[model samples]
Target chain A: MTERKLIVSRRKLLRVGALGAGGLMLSGCDSLNRSEGFRSLLEGAEDLHKGFQRLGGEGALAREFAPSDMSPVFRANGNREIADSAYRQMLAGGFADWALKVDGLVEKPLVLPLAALQSLPQRQQITRHDCVEGWSAIGKWQGPQLSRILDMAGLKPQARYIVFHCADRFGSTPYYESIDLIDAFHPQTILAWRMNDALLPERHGAPIRLRVERQLGYKHAKFVMRIEARDSLAGLHGGKGGYWEDSGDYAWHAGI
Target chain B: MSEAVTSDHFKGGDFVRRHRLSTRIWHWINAVAVLVMLMSGLMIFNAHPRLYWGEYGANSDPAWFEIGSNADGQGLVKIGDATIETTGVLGVWTDSEGVVKKRAFPGWATIPSNYSLADARLWHLAFAWVLGLGVVTYLFWSLLNGHLWRDIRMSRAELHPKHVWHDISEHARLRFPTGAAALKYNILQKLAYSGVLLVLLPVVVVTGLAMSPGMDAWMPWITQVFGGRQSARSVHFLCAFGLVAFFLVHIAMVVLAGPINEVRSMITGNYRLPKDREEG
Candidate 1:
């Protein structure tokens, strides 16, 4: 009788113990999941990633591939055609009369014509375009270094975030993006006017587009109309530095 | 533990030290990190909803793997050479908002429990750091503390085909070691643990690093190692799935071997062995 009673009690013990331990295991994870301390820890990880990436600096260069290695067809993402009337008219005229205005917080507020941009020293690179949505394509981009243009414009002392105002609009607001001086001054950052050894197509941001090579594709603003430098992005369209940032909650620093 | 186990001793009323305190701590820590990573990762995968082979993959190109809804609002998963319908579960389901949509993974299984890829990334990245750092630390600690040398590495004799096959058969038969034999890890447990710690985790981390453009700039070969960024992404997904499989098997082993003893050993570092006469 004692042996049978012992077996019965042990069975109960096993059941209770398993249930209790399993419940604790799950609830522990759940509690941590909901905590602010956990969130901060996650943010700390992001900052660490940013800091580690910035360590490479100007010395770092994105991998450039042979022209033959370019994807047979590059995917055009987000706003292939803009609804802006001005963009339509500019597209119709083949961007002949279009001028990329370089103003705002600059010593020399100059307007650069498409022909003038072509005349500048050009850098052609066949590099991979990584989108945040897990797709990638390689295309040869030819454009003058953005640093060269920024140098020509002569950035003011207060200049910090370099904002690219594009002609395309998602809805009521115009498509735009921004980068810090680190990316703006990088050799790979360019206002590309040509792709795959030919003039850039409307589907892939014709006339001119920003190419901050180290970042995800969203930072490569298309249909660039104006370049503005500001101390902070507080007053920008989304106050988060990009259109996707305002609407989609995308990270402004897409170095990852 | 070697596969050439000379005997099977499953008995009760014996207590043995199964897991070291450090192992238990690391195991549970990883449990949280891995679960968070997998859930958030599913959310990240939803952003693309397609997978392809080779260097570049997009909507225009043919995908080897895809998950989406059909015209009739039914979910479907398409793999190379096969297409299977799985609605109310995978591709199409009701989200947290109680509205039915045809997204790749439902909100119930994702971090943030919504359609926010940005927030999902935050969860994934945060846990990634935890899992990565914890793993590195545990590995180094185990090595220095002689845990790896004393326990994990299999003997040359165990690597023999016949010995290994015997262990496989025993596991298949749901036969577990008890009493004195329970003090050590079986061949299968050793192999599974070592594979996860030494092989799978490192592959997952490196492939993830390869997908980062920042890492590519520092060392272009990082992405090139797997052919390209898209390939790296595919490999990352596969590896995460591998880890999930490992988790499922690990849980099943714990339950099958007796959840009471397994859970207690992990929590308290003392395992009370079941009787050898215990049924399979």
Candidate 2:
């Protein structure tokens, strides 16, 4: 009877020990998961994030620029041509006759020549061009703000995005870019005609290029031939609205 | 006979399986994400190699060092046909008069100049999204399933001064108790893991996002909280340091706590308990 009692006690002790260990394990897990301390920590972090967001506020404007700061040496960083022979011939003649057709979701659908664009109320801005490739250059750019041009063209109410179709090409694909309405009307957003004081060189988009100052270098579209107003970017190449956007996984909103 | 059957049924021994599948998945995922983040982060640090807290630079004229020389105080280099001893950036250079000149010590080594800043930014930002998503998902799933509470909660007894001292003394002596009790993590593990998950990771993410120019419009308060852009950057680096410390401790724990058994449990969700010779 004593032997049997001893065996029973040992079994009971083992079982009790296991239960105690298991309970501790479960408690430790609970502390990690639902403890007041951890919850407060998480809440504090989230509160900080929300508070920052609140302080910054939505639709805050980036700095605008004057024309004197455009870089004297503005170098093109990517491909420079539309592989078609006809386009090359047009380019050789200085593209004077080349008309920039502004259409699609615009009431006026105006086709303005480069000279006509030059004659328009011009804006010159000397601003810093920050590249995603980690370089910055201050340069003066001469052109009309896209907002004024769009206003003249009279964008339809349905128009939400301004797409820049360029003369450059990558393989069989023609280079194209687009920006939303916020950037579209931004004071710094201009279709630049001249770099520094001279007319833009062929390497620097020749007659015209874009200077979306608030964004990184890739957003600065070059070799402009047409400006199309669209309601959505869905039908565009890769549906992301820029050359690098399609080729590289570049964010559609390269705001920084 | 009925008692024997009942005891047999109770001894199934399956519930003590190592780590749950979810825990294992989260652990390994965090491991990979943290490693990639650290490597890329180190590359980015090369931009300003010296670290400083607050606004001061590294005391203007920073003390610097170079690597690759032996302790014999003799410089050594192999020429076309013979070995030459030289020091400094000029090394063993023949002057315009055909006289060989040796300077003392080579140029100071800078941080590793392997990556471009822009490329590093892109990689960091892109991978950041992955890490953020993983963390969020882990938190949500763990919360929903009650895993967090189950693993990290402590009892009043465990919180006692005696128990805490016992743990500390055992740790100091490197005396890890082996048994089912030891199979479960001690209090320190729970605290460190919780602190990292609930505190450090979120702080790093917030500071990083706060430093972005685009997010400035939406989250200016983050800048205010951290003092400024540079301050936020400093905090981000500090939080990253905390995470690295946690990672080192965690690895050490894994090594000490029967690496194979622990690793297999994480991978396969099963662990065989050490056989109890007393019962046998």
Candidate 3:
């Protein structure tokens, strides 16, 4: 009877010990997460990845899939619709009057209406959109090359980053994103006005969206209102160059 | 205590250098790195909680596997048409704070102990550099030092079915190698180590790279080899769990073979071989 009691108590002790150890570990990790210095050490890995990603030519193009390979229903994410009065009015009129303002550090500041953008040279390719959340979707995006537009508005010597000020707002702050010259001038980088052989839907960033194919989905700013070329990303909202990057502490360079 | 007994070259029953400095260093670093990577990777997986095949997969698409909570808040892991309840472990669990969470994989099993995809990615990518570089350097150093060929590489004789079966049966019976025999790895050990080092580690790294959109531009063939990005992700997930399974078995083996002696061998490179019971 005493031996049986000992066996049961020993098992209970073992169970308690295991749970205690597990709890310690979990809390230990949480404390580490709270440490600012440790967080920086972790974030420092991004520089190594940035260097590694740049090893291949900056002009490298993401893989383009076949027509049938496109997702049947490309899931729309983030801000699907804008409740802003101006944005809603533009959407109601089929974005006919909407014009993308190209300014800041450019030799020529221009405002090209939707019709004007459609008149430019258009290139369409089916490419995969990888989200930071770890899902992927393929869709054919058609638009004039961003490089062509950049060339038309001649980038200034100081201009290094291209910022897209989007129409939609997440709670009050408008959605915005920026890319360095390498990605800004990428062949696949375009202000897409059409998706899957149809005009861009409101849910999928109507009028236009920036498709920086090589980067993650969050880097691809939707419902773009203005394109501004700048020397640096500093002094912008939260100064991280992208809405998600600023708000959620997402990596500015999301090539992965 | 006699001076001879404590001396490095002391006359003893059986004391030998079992691990190289390179192997010991890499082993410990890899232990921490793999744990961090796996935990953080689980947190990342929680964001989607679904797995699919082909180049594209999203919420609307049919996933071959998923972990989610039904409307009743009961955690369920679904594989095709089959469903398994995973309550209090995956899909739903009470965190240490006593707050209920509906995320796939409990907080205890994930890094940060809370939901933060950004933080998880930070931990994962950072250690990925360590893990990636460690593998490359270890493999290179092992090859140069003859550690790969002399220790891990299976001989033709050892690869024979009879030899492998003998090792397996002995292992099943908990009859580990004794004295001098303990110095050299048996067929089962060789196979397990080589499988992890040569096949599993390399496959996980390549599959991880395949998931990168930037890598698609530089190495399109990688995605093709895995069938698609999602397929590569599935392969990555499987290989990670494979490593976890190996880790469990490895820990069990260490415990069964005498934890103190086995752990000390890896740490100090000196092993005290198990005594031969039949000799007595």
Model 3: clashing residue pairs?
none
Please report the candidate that would top lDDT against the real structure. Answer: 3
Runs of candidate 1 with Cα error greater than 4 angstroms are A1-41, B1-12, B96-98, B278-280
**Regions more than 4 Å wrong, model 2:** A1-149, A156-178, A186-252, B1-15, B44-123, B154-166, B273-280
> Across residues B32-82, which tens digit of lDDT does each residue of candidate 3 receive?
889889999999999999999888899999999999999998999999999
TM-score per model over all chains: 0.90, 0.51, 0.93
By TM-score, who's the top model here? 3
lDDT of 3 at B231: 94
- At residue A151, candidate 3 shows an lDDT of 98
Q: Return the lDDT, model 2, position B161.
A: 87
Cα error, candidate 3, residue A248 (Å): 1.0
| Candidate 1 per-residue C-alpha lDDT over A12-85 given as tens digits, one digit per residue, 9 for 90 to 100 | 88788668866654455445556888766665666677787878744699989887777888999987987678
- Across B1-280, the per-residue lDDT of candidate 2 in tens digits comes to 0112112223322335557677788887877667556655654554444332321122231212111224554444433335455543323334335544332221111011222443344446555766777888888887887667767667788778899889989877766644455455577776787788788887888777755545644555765587644466667777987998997887787677556555656666756443343543
lDDT of 3 by residue, A5-120 (tens): 96477557656855785676677788888899999998888777777888974678888889989899999999998888988999999988889999999999999999999999
Q: Output the lDDT of residue A77, model 3.
A: 95
Q: How many residue pairs clash in each candidate?
A: 7, 35, 0
